[model samples]
Target: MHKPRILVVDDEPQIHRFLGPALNAAGYEPVRADSGREALAEIARKPPEAVVLDLGLPDLDGQEVLKRARDFYEGPVVILSARDREIEKIEALDAGADDYVEKPFRVGELLARLRVVMRRQQRQQEEPPPVVHAGDLVIDLPRRLVTRAGEALRLSPKEYDLLAKLAEADGKVLTHKELLVSIWGPAHAHDMQYLRVFIGQLRQKIEADPAAPKLILTQPGIGYRFMADEALRPSGA
Candidate 1:
């Protein structure tokens, strides 16, 4: 069995020393990159299952590395940085980092986070289930039908499309720009108003109480995520 590869990008020798053994013990093949340039090169050469990146690098900012990597790399990136400010966290997350961990962190916590992201990635790669169940709602992907409490709910074309997109994400946060670009095309990439309006309409139709939605949770300044518990069936089931 081949262990999943993990790329560690940090300039500190001590970090490499610390994480190398921990990752190996956790069943991951740890690959090291001491600089942003090397990190990018390694990623292009062969992308890892996930990347543990540090924001403070000798040549390039870790955030910049994340932005550039997002151009082509779709793997999970967890920022292991010393920057603990709320703004820094938001910036890194919005820049495409999956999760953030401040420095002086526990190895156990990092391993848990890695497991969550890798599992999420695996789910995303699998063929979407034919039907998804969330609370009292049921989404029939093959029929594009949605029902609440066994009653069919009418949704506009765009609204259904948006809902389908969120459901297909498998609980991942879909950034506002990502949603816009994917749903409305590049010309509407900056149309935040359109997204808000549609989201509101979707909630009204789907949520038992649209005012305080539970199914579609907002990520505030980042994007939206589907938080309702989902029951997914196997592809061939």
Candidate 2:
């Protein structure tokens, strides 16, 4: 039986030294790429189930790798970076990575994150989600269609994806990290600005008053949640 494959894109020899055995011991096949261009070529040639990417690539920047990877690779991309700046994390997540791992991370922690992502991916494939409804809003997830007040609404791909994820977990507060990583990818999870921009756009289209949004409630310092009832928005929501 073939073990699940993982592509590790990092310039550091120590990263490979550390992760190679960890991945192998965890029952995964580890592949290595030392630069962004090499990572891209490897992905195109034989896609791995997941990607471990370092943001500072010598040839191509990590963000460019993610931008190009999004074209053909839909799998999870966990970013590895020593730069702990929030903006950096936001940029990577928005670019299309699945998770972000700060440098000097514990091997156990990295493995745990890998398992979480793999499990989420597997569960998603195993179950078919139900159509979503929130008063005037209607979302047919599988068809990638949405309508509000009995009228179809035009939305960009990213907008629709964000809405769908919100609708999928109706009434649940989706953290900024969760929504960003799930919709935009891990690299972008910290980019709350992108979330704000998209959420504002969504409210304008779906709410009777964009100024006073009811369907999509802001959790304040948390994330956003989709209220199933248009009229039952939480107090001060």
Candidate 3:
């Protein structure tokens, strides 16, 4: 089997230095691009299985890089940036990134996220089951429908997609970018505001208490998780 190819786009040499060995050790072929222009060139020449993009590219804004990347690359694009502001993170995710890593991140965590992306991609290539469930919420993939507590719940196209994706992972946490790409297409992956609004709407329709949700749970400053019904047991029995 061919090793998974990864394109690492960043203006900083340090990032390449830090990530190259890690990726190589993890059995992936790493291709480096020092600027957004170079990144585009690399992508046009040959698209990789995944892209690790930096938001602080010299030639163009990382978000613009993301936009251009979508024209050619269909795989996951994870943003690696120094920006820690919530708004900036939200913007990048909405712009099309599949995940975000703040600067000074742990290599182990980054690799783990990469693995998650790879696994999700692989799952997409295989035959998928018709229905997905989490607690009282059940999604019928063939019918494009959702039901909670034995009652049908109307969900918008995007909302349904989001819920289905989350249900597929069960108790796993999904970053904003991951949800955006899975549901809204790569071009809108960085549009976190849109996700927030839709999630709120979804909660109103599905959750018993949107304020203190029981199913769709938030991981502040990280992402969201769809808690498995079995995992919500009372503390200490």
Candidate 4:
């Protein structure tokens, strides 16, 4: 299977070293560009699914690179810079950045953000299914029904909602804050313990072996994602 390609544009060798394996583990093929000119060249050669860009470049400013890429490339660009000033973020967003994360970012969080931005772009181009089937697990969104190997599973309202949300995410990581706000509302946005309990409950019901779950994957401190990949589906499914 061809993993989604992500362009990592940064002058720092350390950044490239850190992100390359992380991107690969998160199901992305990392393409490297150490300078602004090289980054532009790579994009022109073959635009990637998304880009992780740094503001400081040896050849040209990162903003200038973004502006130039925006002229023709429509892929999402995420600013991954050391610049933490509010004005820098505003300028980057105004210049067409899909998202921004500062240096010393958590790898899990950065991966989650990348998934979110890329998923947003994908949603703009396609419609999601109301039904999700991963192996023996089937989720019927409209009917709010879930089953394992054709046996109907009983789930609480919150469990069903959480499963539905993750299934709809299509393998993208749904950040803890995003999931909490959507399900438990803003009032319970910081309730990580509460979320973990529910996740544990859901896993027990859905996973063949709850201790070694395969259906619903965890992103450590970030959140959860359903393991729904095209490669895992039946042929022509």
Candidate 5:
């Protein structure tokens, strides 16, 4: 099997120095880009399976690079930056970032996120069964519909796509990359913010209590898992 390729876009040499070896050790081939323009150029030349994008670029804003990348590349994008504000994180996620990490992060966490993303991607390519059920929420793949408690729930295209991906995985955790690619196409494989917004929407429509969700569950820094409704029910009742 071919090792997954990851494009690391950062202006700092130190980032490349530290991340290259880390990614290599994690069984990923790392490609480097020092600026937003270079990153775009490299993507145009040949796209990778995933990208680690820095928000602070010398030539252009990292968000702009992310948007442009989504225009063509279909894969997961993990945003790496020094910005630690909650609003910034939310903004990036909404813009289509699959995941976000502040600077000075642990290599172990990064690798874990990578694995989650890739696993989901592999599952999607396999094209498993269309209809998926998680708890009370039932996803009708062909109709792009979701229902809970026997009532049809209206969902945006992106929201429906997100549910379908998670439901397909049953209870397995899906990384940000996997969800982004499955819904927004390959070009948006890195936009995590998009996932956040759609997830919020999905919960609102499906979860009995959106604030304290029992279904669409978050896995901290990793990703998300759609709890099987069957598992939530009492056995042999």
Candidate 6:
């Protein structure tokens, strides 16, 4: 069987020098691209199972590369960069990165992250159970429909995506960055206003009282949580 291919886009030779052997040992076939332009070209030439992208590229910036790659690529793209700032990580994630790893990352940790990404991707591809009921609203995942008290509720594409993401988490808190990246893609990760507007729109339709939402609860500075009912929550009350 062909080893899973990982496109490593970085300008640094040392990264390639070490990553090649390390990835090889980890059962991945590593391909190198020194610049964003080259990375794009390489991706087009041979589609990779996943991408390990660096933010600062000689020819094109990493975020741009990620956006462009997303136009045609559907696989995971993990941002491997030195930029450790929260905003930078948010930007990269919103730009289409599946995961972010700081430059001084441990090989074991990186490998484990890749595994997680792959597993999540696989799970997303697999179909889940048909419906979810949280409070008074019912969501049909396969049909992409939502209803409240037997009346169908209309929702925008983004709103549905956001709600579905939260519902799947089963009462877990999802960070602002995590929700934004997962729903709107990485580019809008920092656009809290967008989230606020959409979340409000969603509440108007799903919540019995938008003024005092019970399904979607704010976690103050951290993020938001889907207040699933005891029966709906994975813990099964």
Which candidate leads in lDDT? Answer: 1
lDDT: the better of candidates 3 and 4: 4
TM-score: the better of candidates 2 and 3: 3
After TM-score superposition, the amount by which residue 234's alpha carbon in candidate 2 deviates from its true location, in angstroms, is 29
The total of clashing pairs for model 3 equals 7
Compare candidates 1 and 2 on lDDT and give the better one.
1
Residue 176 in candidate 6 has what lDDT? 89
Q: Rank the candidates by lDDT, best first.
A: 1, 4, 2, 6, 3, 5
Q: How many residue pairs clash in each candidate?
A: 0, 8, 7, 0, 21, 5
lDDT of 3 by residue, 1-237 (tens): 688889999878888998999999999999999999999998999989899988887889888989988887778887786745656566666665666667778788777667766665666678655776666887788888888888999777778887877777634557777787778889996798988998898889888889977777775665676755433321111
What 10-residue stretch in candidate 4 is worst by lDDT?
228-237
Q: How does model 6 fare in lDDT?
A: 0.78
- In candidate 6, how many clashes are counted? 5
* TM-score of each model, paired residue for residue: 0.71, 0.59, 0.66, 0.58, 0.60, 0.60
**Candidate 2 ranges beyond 4 A from true positions:** 128-237
Which candidate would rank higher by lDDT, 1 or 6?
Answer: 1
Cα-based lDDT at residue 156, candidate 5: 74
Computed on alpha carbons, the lDDT of every model, listed in order, comes to: 0.83, 0.79, 0.77, 0.81, 0.76, 0.78
Please provide, for model 5 over 116-181, each residue's C-alpha lDDT reduced to its tens digit, 9 standing for 90 to 100.
556556666787556677667778888787788779987776677778777766455567776777
Q: Over the full model, what C-alpha lDDT does candidate 2 score relative to the true structure? A: 0.79
TM-score of model number 6: 0.60
Candidate 6 lDDT, 145-236, residue by residue in tens = 99998889888898999999887764444678888878888898788998899889998888888998778887555466676554212121
Tens-digit lDDT track for model 4 on 1-237? 999999999998998898899999888999999999999999999999999999889999999999999998998888876644545655676577776677777788678778767876887578767778887898999899999999999999999988898888665556777788789999998899888999999999998899988888774444666875431221111
For candidate 4, the per-residue lDDT at 74 reads 96
- Sorted on TM-score, highest at the top, how do the candidates line up? 1, 3, 6, 5, 2, 4
* Model 5 lDDT, full chain set: 0.76
